[model samples]
Target: MSSTPINKPSALQADKASATTSANLPEHISLSKWEDSGFEWAGQVASRSFERLNALLTTEHLQSDLEIKANLYRRNNVLHLSFTLTGEVWLTCQRCLQPIAIDLTDDYDIALLDNESQVRLVGEEQDCLLLDEIITEPAPERLLPLKKLVEDEILLKTPMAPKHDDCEMSVEQFGEIPEEEENENPFAALASLKGKL
Candidate 1:
């Protein structure tokens, strides 16, 4: 949501403290900024917007702890950013369909757009990071929704078949194979008929 992206301002070029205000962030998060890093916040993403993940993965509670660390490198309007996200989500087990709590700690490498351009489509969404400057930036305190990302990842990790390997069918359900059926072959049955005649 920040157009400026974040950059390491030289001591002489540092912008006034206005940028560090809590007003810059959405109400759900608590933010703190670090030098050479943008902003870090830990909280939930959203209930309505993330309904898919909510339905697919049963959260331990409606609440999840999400953390994002991001920083940008800007030179001549070219911006590069790196993010590290950490969080946890509850998922159903593939085998038993039991509750499984999965933790997420992932690192994302990306580049940010310097300004609006026809190339906006190059990296305009969550799937891909845009191309801008040649420099690769890896900074903590990035701006990413860690909770939602982990939720999706956990959903993906869910197994398609939900049968537990250790489970067994009851004896009656197992059913016995008929020994007489196995001993008799069609060819053998024909030979016995010839002897009888």
Candidate 2:
């Protein structure tokens, strides 16, 4: 139902209102501008590696090495945003407590709305966000933070408990081996009593 224009350069410039450093990815965007030019972004952002993931990541300062694309275009009075991310990231393996590479790739289609109540006006069945087929977000100021949006998608894809397919750690370290228990037959005691009788 929706399509994103790929490989188009971004016309958006840094905003004077927001404080930004060179290290930070594009943070905020005006939805109006996006709709006007049909914004497109594709590049690798190294600053957003595993180290920047806050408490979700255990290791720090690993290679970011991520490729991302974000496309925003308006269609039929509705604003749509399509995002895709792909790369390899290191995550602390739960099994061995060591860094393991995890393939990161995801894509989402979002239908933008001015407010939450507008969903009622649009009728329930048409909402892409509610159906989970496409995401919908409220745009009160028509401005959104892109950094958070991209980071959130990556975080959602992050493995909650990372582990390697062939774990190098010994089984003993992962779990305790079950000890064998001696079996005693209750029938043996009953037979001994019957013989004495």
Candidate 3:
């Protein structure tokens, strides 16, 4: 009888394996395959991974990670994508020009349409995402990069002018407003001359 040695994986190795399997979404996904399979993916992506999104931030180095959940399914013979994103981002305060943290929590239900004509079929109220608009590479039809979708959603949810809830413009920002002395007012002199006349 031959004895075989069993080598168990270390705790760190196990954790790394699990993390990679759990958090990594496919770089490119075929919409038809995902819908047919009823695919659901949940992951955490570093905020700094999105270049365009980071360009709009106060700093490129961010410690926060975006939690993303994506579901692809077919409804009424139309492909629909349900996505939820939750994260925290830092933006420059429009009022004070200081870094302010903003919490993002948004849900998107988008109808995936092959062409613009199908937009009417999805109805006006439904958010329609045209496949033509997102297809950058010469890959198979209905194939898209998941990162692009996540980045686009984040950009849409980001506020154009983000500020703290209780932020106030301090006098130090623009300096104190000069007080107007009565004698320094030309209009006051004109009113006095008219009264004397």
Q: Rank the candidates by TM-score, best first.
A: 3, 2, 1
CA RMSD per model (angstroms): 10.6, 7.1, 10.7
Answer with 1 or 2, whichever has the higher TM-score. Answer: 2
Highest TM-score scorer:
3
Q: Can you give the lDDT of residue 24 in candidate 3? A: 57
Q: Can you give the lDDT of residue 184 in candidate 2? A: 92
State the C-alpha lDDT per candidate: 0.44, 0.61, 0.70
**What local lDDT score does residue 94 receive in model 2, on the 0 to 100 scale?**
83
List model 1 lDDT by residue over 119-143, tens digit each. 4534545233333232233444334
Give the Å shift of residue 85 in candidate 1.
1.3
| Total colliding residue pairs, candidate 2 | 0
Quote the positional error of residue 122 for candidate 1 in Å: 15
lDDT of 3 by residue, 5-106 (tens): 122235523543454457655566676454444455677877777889888778633558778777666665666777788888888888878888877778
For candidate 1, give the lDDT: 0.44
Q: In model 3, how large is the Cα lDDT of residue 73?
A: 64
lDDT of 3 at 55: 81
Query: Residue 196 CA error for candidate 1 (Å)?
Result: 25
